[model samples]
Target: MSRRRSARPAPRPLRPAAERIVDKRDGQWFVRPITGATSVKTYTCPGCHAPITPATPHMVVWPVEKALLSADAIDERRHWHSACWTRRH
Candidate 1:
């Protein structure tokens, strides 16, 4: 028997996720069509210049109890696997 790959349609990437700005104060994410200091910028990977997509840089600020904490727990940049992120490095 031959194995068949799952045939699911590609999901539409979130517009804001594709282009976003995050409010660290409230852990809220704002989608922006333009690029700014706060907006997450997509760049070419240093190793291969392959385009890299990083989810908007956001801080976890929710549930009240978790407020006032440092910005260290958010895994905001995992869109690209390590191999791709550091391919050139």
Candidate 2:
């Protein structure tokens, strides 16, 4: 009698490192880079107070804290131009 062998499972794909944590004097910030291909809407940059048009590559920043809830963090998030975010003091 011939025995049947089970098939091996497919390996999981590795996830990209898309988000980073930045420590500033004010607080710990979670920054995510938005690629032009994925940016779909316009946003006002808090750093320069200018409009970030659709398809523009930018950074999205939000403060992180033990006491801060997920909803609050989302509400506090801001979109900034890459240059402006880098230059923010």
Candidate 3:
């Protein structure tokens, strides 16, 4: 007896590139767009020395060149308020 195979749809392709931001003074930072569906985490802003509350929408930044490993660098990344980050200069 011949068995029939069930057809499955192809998986969606991953994003080609991630959005990144580069600040001459601040080095580089990766941009992460957070949808409302995901839980938001709070962080302290290094620029203004203020807290970045959850669900507020902000930026995550890390040094462009560091001696630490990538994982460690990411771990050292800082969260900042969008406006504050823009006026960081």
Candidate 4:
């Protein structure tokens, strides 16, 4: 008797260094590139007090540790201009 063949392909492996969240002395920051596939959203930059236009590449940052709840922290996340964020150092 002939053996039945598998129809599905093998699953791909996950990358070890694919994490986007970074832990610093202040808090945890999520870093990611704005891709064309993503829908854009407008945000005000805390550094420059200017609006971050949609479809523009930028950075999203939030504090990891806070007295408030996790939901509050997520809501408080800010989108910043790439240059503005870099100058914060």
Candidate 5:
């Protein structure tokens, strides 16, 4: 018998900016968008001027928020933009 794969819509990508309004050992309590309305702390990428987004579960986030952290926190200091990181083949 042959099996067929179902076509599910690709998930919405993460937001360009998000903040850890709440931090815990488990994870962020609440992370909202980084917009001009609020004083969202952000770092500009040296390479692309595009805002950097966080690396998060592709599933947990639908129209997700970018995770920002101290440069020392992540394995690589290189921050990623939602579009840049979520680039599909």
Candidate 6:
């Protein structure tokens, strides 16, 4: 007997998190929080120089100026551990 496949709609992609501007001693930045549910890819945290594994909550940050004029702003963004980003001077 042949089995029939059931029809199911694909899961919708998560909407991007709301971004906030941060003022640091170095410069202004555009920051967004990444929730565990939406965190899929592994990334390196520049602050701690460690790997941010999938499903781990983190922060995505980039220079405001770079983000404003760059077409590849997403590529310039870095994923950082929440605590590390907070403690960074």
The C-alpha lDDT values of all candidates are 0.40, 0.85, 0.67, 0.68, 0.39, 0.90
Tens digit per residue, CA lDDT, model 1, 2-89: 9988799889774542544444454454332323334365755434556545553322111222334545434232233335432312
List candidate 6 stretches off by more than 4 Å.
Answer: 1-13, 67-73
TM-score of each: 0.22, 0.73, 0.60, 0.57, 0.23, 0.77
Task: Give the C-alpha miss distance for residue 18 in model 5, angstroms.
Answer: 14
Q: Please write out the lDDT profile of model 5 over residues 1-89, one tens digit for every residue.
A: 99978699779885566543444344433333333343334555434566543433211112123346533333233433434433422
Model 6, residue pairs in steric clash: none
Off-target runs (Cα >4 Å) in candidate 1 are 1-39, 56-81, 85-89
Encode model 4's per-residue lDDT on 1-89: one tens digit a residue.
Answer: 99988898888884433227776566677655454234277778898999888877777776655436555656666777878877775
lDDT of 2 by residue, 6-41 (tens): 698778785643898998888898999998887899
Model 5 local distance difference test score: 0.39
- Of 2 and 6, the candidate ahead on lDDT is 6
Number of clashing pairs per prediction, in order: 1, 0, 0, 0, 1, 0
| TM-score preference between candidates 3 and 4, better one | 3
> Model 2 — TM-score against the truth?
0.73
Residue 27's lDDT within candidate 1 is 49
Candidate 1 collision pairs: 47-88
Instruction: Tally clashing residue pairs in candidate 5.
Output: 1
Better of 3 and 4 by lDDT: 4
Task: Give the top-scoring candidate (lDDT).
Answer: 6
Instruction: Rank candidates, TM-score, best first.
Output: 6, 2, 3, 4, 5, 1
